[model samples]
Target: MPMQAAQWSKALLADALAPVYLLVGEELLVLEAADAIRRRATTLGYAEREVLEAGPQFDWDNLARAAAGMSLFASRRLLDLRLPGGRAGKDGGAAIQAFCADPPPDVSLLITATEWSSKHESAWSKSVDQLGVQVVFQAPRPNEWGRWITARLASHGLSASSEAAALLAERVEGNLLAAAQEVDKLAILHQGGRIDRAEMERLVADSARYDAFKLTDAAFAGDAARALKVLAGLHAEGEELIGLMGWLVNQLQLVLRLASAEDFASQARAERLWPAREQLFRQALRRAPRQHWLGCLARAGRIDRMAKGRESGEPWREAERLIAAMALPRGSLSAP
Candidate 1:
């Protein structure tokens, strides 16, 4: 079985290190997990490190050669293998399986991939799991972001109210690296003081880029005025209609998924929704049927074409109409 990312720290406390370890998933989390593993290996006297970038043209034999050859001065070494796109082709898989079959003494192999899903699993990964450790560092879901931010703030010796954390979560929009940077900035600016929502708003940079995400949230929350205001802001800032439509379409699709489910509570849990976001979706579903969201999504495609010059119409006007249809009550939308 693969180890949970949260359990990795506790596992590192063990006296002995595994011969092979694989860390995969979101880039920031994967990088951080790899860093922790490297630190632990260093402390255990793995004095030498060799990095191998496993790109499409990489020679799989190099892994074996690296295992066989270590610096004369260093008795122990860490082999860092980076799998781009989280795939090891047949040859690469064979090489990894061979390595696991007879892993060299005094050598630790750390494989890190920046992306992964159920499809990424294979025999070689299973081999690593059997011999050592495998971890998937999943990003927090949209609803889980606030809790993650709160925990992260705590790590920086800062305390924030749930509202403040939720605000920060909205600002970052599931970008872990951006969230980390914002938390670091707050720690410096606030000196680890307890922060409120208003203070958080005042302290964080006003990132116009994430307004697209907020646009959908506003619509979901039934704040038509706020949603339209954000849409206008995005338009004035020269944000691409297609870019904005991308997130809008994604969210509408999620709503369709939820609305179509026979069991909403179970589906929400499967989607990893937190209570706040769950409430937002609940209200959205109540206000509009799945067919309504489907219509909006289809309209979004037309806007995409308009933006791309393949269709006739003002994409911005169409986008505003779409937002209004989503944000307003069932009979409240006016013709554009």
Candidate 2:
């Protein structure tokens, strides 16, 4: 049976190392889990480690050879296999089963997959699970990010209040790698002191890329092409779809209010919109009616559900459609 990656550390401490260990999950978590295993294996006298990349054109025979070959540097060895897509072809599966059936003495195998799901499991994976250990690491849910950030900050000898952690969580979105980097930076800047929300806001404001906010600005400014580029940039930078949707939803709600308001100037002042943003909304509201923004807001909610895995559509693609709807005049062009 497979285990949660978070439980691996405790399991490692309680039990002896298995002859083979398979780790599959999000890239950062999987890499970190593999690193932890490597560290433990090293301390247990598995002094020599060899890496094998199982790419599309890789020879399946190499696994068998690695198991049969003697280690030159140490009595015990580790075979670190990198299986990028997690699917072992028929020959690769057979080779793995053969090695597991009568594995070489004192040689451990560590297989890692950065992309994994139930569909990626195979006979080879099951064989390893039967004879060894398999751990899966999943990215935290949207609501779990703040707690994760708080714990990570503690690990770095820094403390953050709940609000501060939540702020960082929102800023980093659900990207664990980026969150880790930010925590490291904060540790250095604050020297392990407690981080407040204001400090986090400062960091976020300073680091805020033009792409995130500009995505909305571009859409509001009736530039669908620029919005698409900005959205793609945010995606490339590892910003979670849900995070992008959060701001998009906010903008849509603001537009709805502004569009429906009987007194636009008073409402803008009440909402504390800056002069520039008020002007932008005034221009955007002119291109489309209140009903249009309402429709877009409804679509945004659907996108958010998709982003959170509650719906089936591709959130990114749906987001692109939403941007097109907001940026272009009604009936000017259909969403691609």
Candidate 3:
């Protein structure tokens, strides 16, 4: 059965061992679930751990081989498989189904994917569903965030008044990773005492002031200074680089799609540009040529690799450069 992240702990306590587990989501909840699974597996005698990243060039045979192989010392092994693109092509699908049909008793498979659309419900997913557990991690909604924050605080042996929890929720703005870090910081600073609104106001920086959408808006308005400021603020606030890059890639793709239209009016209509944002899009389109946006998209891919530590050089500096190239006036890209 598909389970929510909140249900994972209790479920694990009830039945900690499973032949296979599939985790799908992009939120930090996925990370927490993975950690919980690992901890429980460790306790259940899955002493050997093997991790594999299934990327474009990954071989499906390796998955089969790993499952078949046995650990030299440990009787039981844990297989941690990560599919970054959340896809198993034809070959991968077949392998997954085959494994599901007769999973190795000595090994436990924990498969994770960043995305899972309707198209992902293939034979492999169905096999996993019938054979093991599937969990989906989603962020809490606005109405649920305060309670989420309060629970996170309690985990650290810290309590907060309702107002303080709401303030913290507002400050983090639904970013669970940021909220978790803030809760940890508060636990250290307050030494596990109750927190109130005034202390929250004084201690918590307004990291929520700049989000990906706001940064994109600033860039689309050709406000290079403001965009750069937001970029710095988000980085300082410990915002996830992958989330930031994903937004930039999406915005650039939208612009590229519209730029190919017959005229500005047609493009605007195709993009469903609201009256408030039409001018901003127009200004953005005018400031740079289509080729510039294409280059930005290409660089966004490189920045993603950099952020993941797959490529060398500083990711943040490259991100700043990409933002300036897209957001600044064409000739003023080198401006301080």
lDDT of 1 at 59: 99
* C-alpha lDDT of residue 154 in model 3: 87
Compared with the true structure, all predictions reach lDDT values of 0.83, 0.80, 0.77
Span of ten consecutive residues with least summed lDDT in model 1: 205-214
Worst-scoring 10-residue span by lDDT in model 3:
327-336
The reply for model 2, stretches above 4 Å from the true place, is 207-336
| lDDT for each residue of candidate 2 in 174-257, tens digit (9 for 90 to 100) | 756556656755665574567789877765552334356667877987878978887777777777888778889998999988
Q: Give the Å error, residue 92, model 2.
A: 0.7
Q: In candidate 3, what are the lDDT values of residues 100-152, reduced to their tens digit?
A: 98998878888988687767778888888889888877778889989988998
Tens-digit lDDT track of model 1 for 251-331: 888888999999785698788764445656877897888877778778888888898999999999988888888898575
Error of 2 at 209 (Å): 14
Q: Indicate the residue-level lDDT of 241 in model 3.
A: 92
What total of clashing residue pairs does each candidate reach? 0, 0, 0
Model 1 ranges off by over 4 Å: 205-336
Error of 1 at 315 (Å): 30
Candidate No. with top lDDT: 1
